[model samples]
Target: MLSKVITIAQQKGGTGKTTLAVHLALAFVKYHNLKVVIIDTDPQGSLGKWFMVRSKKNSLNKNLTFKTASLWGAQYESKTFKKDHDIIIIDTPPKIESDARPSIEAADLVLIPMTPSHVDFWATEAIIEIAKKAQKKVLVQINRANQRSKLINKTHEYINSIKVSATNIIIGNRQIYPSSMGEGKTAVEKQKKSKAVEEIKKLSEQILLELK
Candidate 1:
């Protein structure tokens, strides 16, 4: 079988879409020892920056390599990606433009990350509609959740009422995420055994199971 392509997308920014993509890619490489390639499709190139820093520091293992590719290059990259790689994770821009459409269309699964807010939820719906139209498997990751907040609980309930499969893994708001990313390190590597790493790991496992 061909490699599984996973696209991380969200119409609204600051939802940790790129963070999830990078950590998940690292998790697959670190834990499963899978040959993984990350396609930095976002114009911001957050994933690319992370890869560069990690490469400079020799933080990543030999099993993984993150490559930078334009949104327009997604089809070509996917076509030419090595069969030896276990998975290809694509980080898309924060809009539903023509460029972003191709990444979503080419993906085996589309993951939409959002916070527990009405605006974020609405934006997620728009993305989900597009994914549904493209006939792609769509999943939502609730990022930066506050367990004690009523809004978070309500948002979770609302998401469950929807037809899409919302991931049970909830990534809480943590200082480590912003602090470590500033140094070009992933939360998992910077704060090992922290809650943030554990949550991201669970999310990664759920994604792998779905792909399986």
Candidate 2:
């Protein structure tokens, strides 16, 4: 079967795009026993580094396979590699560059991760417009939410008004995520009860359900 390709993108940087991509890829491999692959399309290559760390420590799971490639590489592979894997998650760059366009175009689903802030909200419009132009399924994931803040509700309303699908999952700010990445471990295994892990797992399940 052809793999479901999901591209995690945000024009604005530091929005947890790579983090979500890495964790979600691992989640699918661990929980569902699916052959998951991650394409590090980002120029920063944060996702590539995470995989490198896992490989060096011999902590990488046999079920999870990842490769680093540019956006052009993704397009080339999409045409040929879709049938070999169960899922391919692409970690896109944080700019509306020439490379990002093709990855977005090749995606079956485009997940835009952002925090609950005015700057992120404003930047989302451009990303959403690009995804819409590509005619892909676009969903917004609210990252780094604070339970006591009203920004989450406001951002949800704003995105809904703009007719974007906002996920019911809200990943809160947690130190365990960064810490787990530093140790080359998935957040779900590092901080089992943290809100971050719960939210990401829910989001992953939702994505799987949607794909089915």
Candidate 3:
């Protein structure tokens, strides 16, 4: 089987790109039973930091591995990593830059996480363009959505207005996500029965369907 590359990207920061990358990696290993590797292309190294916590806490999954890539390049890095893993999840930087393009280019599917706001939706155009230039499929989602708000419908329309494929699943803004991550735990380990956990499980299913 070919290794699938899923790049979690958004042109703007605070759009929950890293969150998606990390959790999706865990979901693939824990729920989908796939060998997963996370490549952090973001200079911020947020994913790497979490992996450190996992190692320190002994929570690291043997099936999941983490690696970091330089901002200077990635086309070569992506190709090399896929040789060993079932899924190569790339966490790209929060901008459309020389670095992010190669990561998006290397993706089989690029996931754009948008907050439920006009600004977040508007920020997606440039990254989506880069993904299209690379001819990669994209899935847009209202990530960290305010579950109690009515704007979810508007966000859906906005995503569609831009002619991008939108996933029916939306991730909610919940304290549990970060709290669990801080402790080197994922929803699968901490809040197995919580709403946040269910959202991630659904996201994995939607993502699989999109990949098909």
| TM-scores, each model vs. reference | 0.91, 0.94, 0.94
Estimate, for each residue in 51-135, the C-alpha lDDT of model 1 and write its tens digit. 6776787674676767778877875687567466788888887866545777887788999888989988877777787788899
Global lDDT of each candidate: 0.80, 0.83, 0.82
lDDT of 2 at 55: 81
Cand. 1 Cα-lDDT: 0.80
Where in model 3 is the C-alpha error above 4 Å? none
Question: Model 3, 163-197: lDDT tens per residue?
Answer: 88988887899998898889877876787688888
lDDT tens string, model 2, 76-124? 7765668788888888888764457788888899999989998998877
In model 2, what are the clashing residue pairs, if there are any? Answer: none
For model 2, the superposed segments whose C-alpha errors exceed 4 Å read none
How far in Å is the alpha carbon of 106 misplaced in model 2? 1.0
Provide the clashing-pair count of each candidate structure: 0, 0, 0
- How close is each model in CA RMSD to the real structure? 1.8, 1.5, 1.4
Count steric clashes of candidate 3: 0
Worst 10 residues of 2 by lDDT: 188-197
TM-score of 3: 0.94
